[model samples]
Target chain A: MSQFKYRADTEGMLNTYLDWYKQAEYILSLKPSLPDKFKTSKGAREYHRPQHIIICGLGGSGIAGDLVKDALGNEIKVPIEIVKEYTLPSYAGEETLVIAVSYSGNTEETLSCYVEAVEKNCMIASISSGGYLKKFSEKTGALHIDLMSGYQPRASLPQLLFAILKTLETLKIVSGQPYAEVIQVLRENKTNFSPENEQNKAKELAEKLYRKIPVIYGHSFYKGVAIRLKNEFNENTKIPAKAEVFPELDHNDIVGWEDNELSKNFTAIILRNEEEYMKERIEATIDIMKKYGAEVIELSSRAETVLAKIMDICHLGGLASIYLALLYGRDPALIEPISLLKKRLGEKVGLQKKLLEKLSKTVSQ
Target chain B: MSQFKYRADTEGMLNTYLDWYKQAEYILSLKPSLPDKFKTSKGAREYHRPQHIIICGLGGSGIAGDLVKDALGNEIKVPIEIVKEYTLPSYAGEETLVIAVSYSGNTEETLSCYVEAVEKNCMIASISSGGYLKKFSEKTGALHIDLMSGYQPRASLPQLLFAILKTLETLKIVSGQPYAEVIQVLRENKTNFSPENEQNKAKELAEKLYRKIPVIYGHSFYKGVAIRLKNEFNENTKIPAKAEVFPELDHNDIVGWEDNELSKNFTAIILRNEEEYMKERIEATIDIMKKYGAEVIELSSRAETVLAKIMDICHLGGLASIYLALLYGRDPALIEPISLLKKRLGEKVGLQKKLLEKLSKTVSQ
Candidate 1:
């Protein structure tokens, strides 16, 4: 009977998403981020020796850093900690390396935490552009690598993520060469991954999963993608989703699907990269899931490098979720109620102001 | 105009749940489970040699094996694999040790897999009540440990779980004393954590979260608890909930909280124990969740053994979910669709008849 509040018609909504993609394309156009930007010498010496790496940020920007720690934790000799609070853990000390990330450089939470990291005398690094975070890093002499930010934070995942990984390599936690090559591979293969007909597994998935909740699953190293898919659906399409890993899921969650009634409204998207072949447990798992009414989408990784294959698919999944939102005729940008809730919480607790000196430091056994 | 199909009337439905609990109690009473009911000390002595272990089962039973792997993974020298399907991994060799678990030995998937483990020449052991599983184990000359049944498989979690721990100890992978103490502590502490009123965090959590989705977060060792909580809710109340660990959630999922619409319907419950205090990262991350729209319910472990704490809260959470289902006027006992889905699936894909074989084993470098 009437035009929609956000879009005039179906065609208009599609165009709006196109516009969203165009805005993101400009940011992604920027060159090799992080280590390329920092160009640190191969063996740039010296360190106060950080025992804990505290990452402070939220949403998309924070997740990339969190993922790096998760995948690399078993490999990394030191503990990689992700600090999500405005206040520091009581363990904060001078030995901590606190990396404050904000793609917009204006994210309030990241800025609030940056000040705390400074107060605690922890090593601080900023990943952002033209905001309070950028200004604070410049004024305070903290290591600030300007993030190319024209797109939404969710879209600018690679640039922000690259900085965190490069920082880790700079710190001698792991090598960055393979990870850096991943970014190039991801960019090199975008057009092939588009939602053009049935060729796009990401888009085909979005179509098949039009109305159902997604129960995404992945394995050890690439767990980040599953987390990414769940939130992308939640934030972009306003659809519900959750993810779990294996062979751990086999132990308990398999029994859950038995004698349950939720089979109709859910789908399991198993992220099956080249490495999926490594897990014998997964075949049994996939077989078990097939027994349920659940539809399993076998997702394969692309590109030559693991990093490239991971990012390309994860980002495509992000776009697929946005398209799903368009299909549902919902606004992808507005999150007003959550903002209101945060405002209410802020007044009631004064939580941010109360914990201004927060930093997290790691201790030895 | 008529009435809700399954859930009819709220108060009357609760009577049904109480009746199910009563039935479960009667089942437990009549069975009087013994850990050593079908144990063969000679068989156990013969079955322990191996370079690696694969624990096979589903749901609560599967998770117990996984929990041991997660908690003691670094502490134990050999890697443990958890299998949920009706087959084994391709890497099974003469050195492989397999533990087959099925609370009800009639459980189809485990039986399918148990048969395969036999063909693969895996040193095998069985954990179940009298059923096809025990019969198969006897015929196949495999070691077997019979557990008391009648409580829902989800309810008899401790029996399936702890027996595996004891089995592992008998294999010389661990000291048997810690687990025995854990069981003793659990037996002594079940009084306060049982149903109805006064200091029952699970009951309180359920009442508060009657119409909300529970997002349970846990630490490394206790992530299994969060998994258990989600499964318990599924099998007991037929509700959909999700779980993730701390540092992991901080990465990407925090963005899902940025929803204006979904936030109203979602509630996050965090699972914490001693790890919360030791892992400052978890504490900081939980603080961030508090800032967001998350309704935090911190469940602390009673100062006993890990087994006691897990069993105590899990039983309480199970009761609460069933009660909540009753409060919503839903039938807690009917898992019709899930059962039907399995039947339909068995017929649809020629999966049941497919030759179950071993898949490639992951060689973690």
Candidate 2:
């Protein structure tokens, strides 16, 4: 394996990628303890199984919910909903298990949802580094897991995801932790994706994606992975990207590629699956895209478990995005637009206060 | 209002928009009848209230599930999930209400979902324009609504959406139909969006969006509307368009706009809302985008109810996409890529047969 070098990784995002397995390992090593109220007289956990699960957070922190759902598709008995907004669904009540995740624990939207979940009497567990969420959890007796800080929320996905899975395991909502397998797979694959590896798939994908808008496609199983790749491209590559799922895109988005001029500007990256039917549909879709003058790249993972497969794709996509940013001569860690938005939003105070007031009105009703 | 003209709408899509209210009226005029097995001896419909609802469809038909969920956010008692794939969620069982919708009736994915729903014993209802889905419904005793034929599935959205709403009302899952108010709102606003009206907002939007990638942003309430608009731009305008929900985009997507040269190639269309907090967030987001060199257009609805507001946006977006197609000298109804895909898929004989065989294996397990 040849060692690859990165030019514009000012914040060591590549190094962070190399150490992701350690984050997962650290999170998995910690035992998630159930609250006393959730335990029975025999010192065994006893409670009504939640009818559904709602994971609330935004941006980097919020994505864990989607990854978890994609990793455990149809395996968990209950349906999982990811909330990216400030309000909880009307049906979220006592029977709902609400997991609030925020890397900084200060995201206003997640905080709003945390309040609503509490008001609705939903069973709650929260993961955060340190912020108002941890303070609130301490006062309210909600289950809280402390996260190690200092990393960007987007870079801390492993910690956030493993924490949620561990909590779910402790609650008996999901059986068997796949953390070990996921860590092992990612660790083994890291060398192949490393910057020093001249023939790394991530570098090849980044080269093809240079100066082109990427339209990432994934199936039902890897939908979250596709979205995460799009987000990574947007944030890391500093270019617009699109993500759409298969069968869904076949219904409408396929037509968008008919214009030769417009279609040539996009490169479609398909996250391929092994299922025979899905494979056939993807093959047909690729032929159609190619006929319209669009470039296509197909990526498949060799990871053993579902969680491992998802993480493997994500890991490769993350490295590719950073390389793409370097090719564009940009600092991968820079996100001045978000900082400006935050500054402007901070100038207009009382947004959260108003949100809380509205929540209170709903609660009263 | 000054009269505007369309040059390339060969299929009369504008006329269909003009007659959308009639489609709603027609669907509402028919009283949906519940299956006898779902009724009680008290002469009233009685059955276990579904713990959740799943709508299965693709393309034009599948969009109804999203629009309904958007229109009735937090208003419906049960959570609604839209399935765009060949299989149902493993958790979908007797207590889950499955409404399978396929405008063409023979949509492969919907048919597959229907078969799975049957094997899982989900409460099933279907809507189609006379295809295998209808035949299956009749043979299996599932309720089926027949849609008027001859229009493109995308052009027949109102019929499909209203039929689903009517069926839900008949099942006592949703109360007090908003069909009348929605029709009234669309009719009252139709002239303002017609091509003949020079002051039409849709035409103006199309003019602004010409030759630019459209990045549409909607809040939680209008997320479906944003997606529908993106789909319209894809199928009708034959251009790449993107949609992201607000608050969520503020987290990651906002970072993608930092490159001045790249940001100038796109336009942002924000579907504005009335909520105070959402309004503030949109304003902050707009400022950030403008600072990054992207053009921004903000649209707000004056309709009173949620469903009406949703329809109003859809109507405007539909008209705008058509005008955009005309601007590009292309027919709005032409979707040759999708046709080619379908043809290729058809050539792969026994794809559906293989899907069924796999599904049966899972069932037998």
Off by over 4 Å in 1: A1-189, A192-214, A217-228, A231-240, A244-315, A321-365, B1-49, B70-75, B86-91, B177-201, B275-279, B345-365
**TM of each candidate vs. truth:** 0.58, 0.93
* Candidate 1 local lDDT, B192-277, one digit each (tens): 43454377554566677676666677765566778777876665565667887654454455545554345445577766665322
Tell me how far the alpha carbon of residue B42 in candidate 1 is from the true structure, in angstroms, after superposition.
Answer: 20
Prediction RMSDs, each to the true structure = 10.1, 4.4
Model 1 has an lDDT value of: 0.58
Error of 2 at B245 (Å): 0.5
* Model 2 chain A: lowest-lDDT 10 consecutive positions: A38-47
For the second chain, the TM-scores of the candidates in order are 0.78, 0.92
- lDDT by residue (A1-365, candidate 2, tens digit) is 22234666888987887788988888877877777653111222324589989999898888888999888887886778999988888899878888999998778889888777767777878899987778656645657889988888888888988888887887888887666788887787678878778878988999888778888999876899899898898888888888999889987888888876766767899998757667787888888888778799989888778888888888889889988888887877888888887776767764545544554454344
Model 2 chain B: ten consecutive residues of lowest lDDT: B38-47
Question: Weakest 10 consecutive residues, lDDT, candidate 1 chain A?
Answer: A36-45
TM-score of 1: 0.58
- Model 2 lDDT tens row, B162-236: 898888888887787566788887787677876567777888988888778888998876998889898998898
